[model samples]
Target: MPANHRYSARTAFLLLACTVLASCGGMGGSSINPVNWVTPYKIDVIQGNFVSKEQVEQLKAGMTRDQVKATLGTPLMASLFHADRWDYVFTLKRQGVEPQSYKYTVFFKNDQLERFEGDAMPSETEFIAKLGKRRKLGDVPVLEATEAQLKAAEKPKSATASAAVPASVPAGAPPASYPPLESAKQ
Candidate 1:
């Protein structure tokens, strides 16, 4: 190839590469990017302690820390600096749905639960319902066979067979016994 043609080709390739890279760089934060339109699958992220309303309701003013822990698994955040305070935090992040976060704080005095407060905790059923996706079901088809179809499916018995014998063993045959798995000692 001529020197000029080779130089031109090199320049064109360099320009193409730069353009492609620039386009990709621009797409990182742009809403119009192809990736933005078709999002990659993101698994549901569930984090921290999930304290239900029932569990919180079980908490009493004089209940011990162990009792509180028993009712509501374990505290997600327990700081050494704040020995008397235990924080229970729950966060759920799922694609195509708003993220959910709930925080509950328990204060203890003399190793006994003094008071507890935080965001209104959801019932177990309510939390479960939020996690599940409800899809509209299509009309179901009839599953049971019609009487005519059942009659058509019946097989005619063979003339030579007096009775249907069990597939594994004959009706009158005794059950076969197996030897002991271990050998008898001398």
Candidate 2:
């Protein structure tokens, strides 16, 4: 309410604003943020049971192993290396895509019977219960390298200077000239 008190408060507020602004100005130019965390619990659940809409109707649990496989087809990867667990990973991705997968892992107790699991990962019984019918399989996928990628894959050679940076004439520079006397007289 007093004049000196009001002036002091305004001065303190301005100093605080300047300090905050100065601290923040450098952050916009940098590539990395100082604070980040990547705990497994906080990670995205890209993995899950993702059956095509048709498979939605017929999938039911307690179906025999053969019946489940017939409905879902073979697991994406099975281990002769380990054997018991089967991984049926299906992704909903577009062309030229790197879609995240829904990893439905089935751990068979005997390596033949289903066991416990991580979430989004379905029980084999659940997957079977979920599969209404067989969905048609599509072509296997591949990524073609870009031109820069192919060039980078090639062995590096410093001798190919022209290939790396072709010489550029200055924007308004005149073309180089030969002697006019000889060319013109002849």
Model 2: worst 10 consecutive residues (lDDT sum): 35-44
lDDT of 2 by residue, 1-186 (tens): 999999999999999988876776667754442322222333223443354434433445455556556765677878798676667776544333345456555555532445423335455565555442333467656678889999999987676754655468545567688556655544
lDDT of 1 by residue, 62-128 (tens): 9999999999889999999999999999998888788999999999999999999999999999988
Candidate 2, superposed: residue stretches over 4 Å from native? 1-64, 95-98, 116-186
- The candidate that achieves the highest lDDT relative to the unseen native structure: 1
Cα lDDT over the full model 2: 0.57
lDDT of each: 0.88, 0.57
Per model, how many backbone clashes are there? Answer: 0, 13
- lDDT score, candidate 1: 0.88
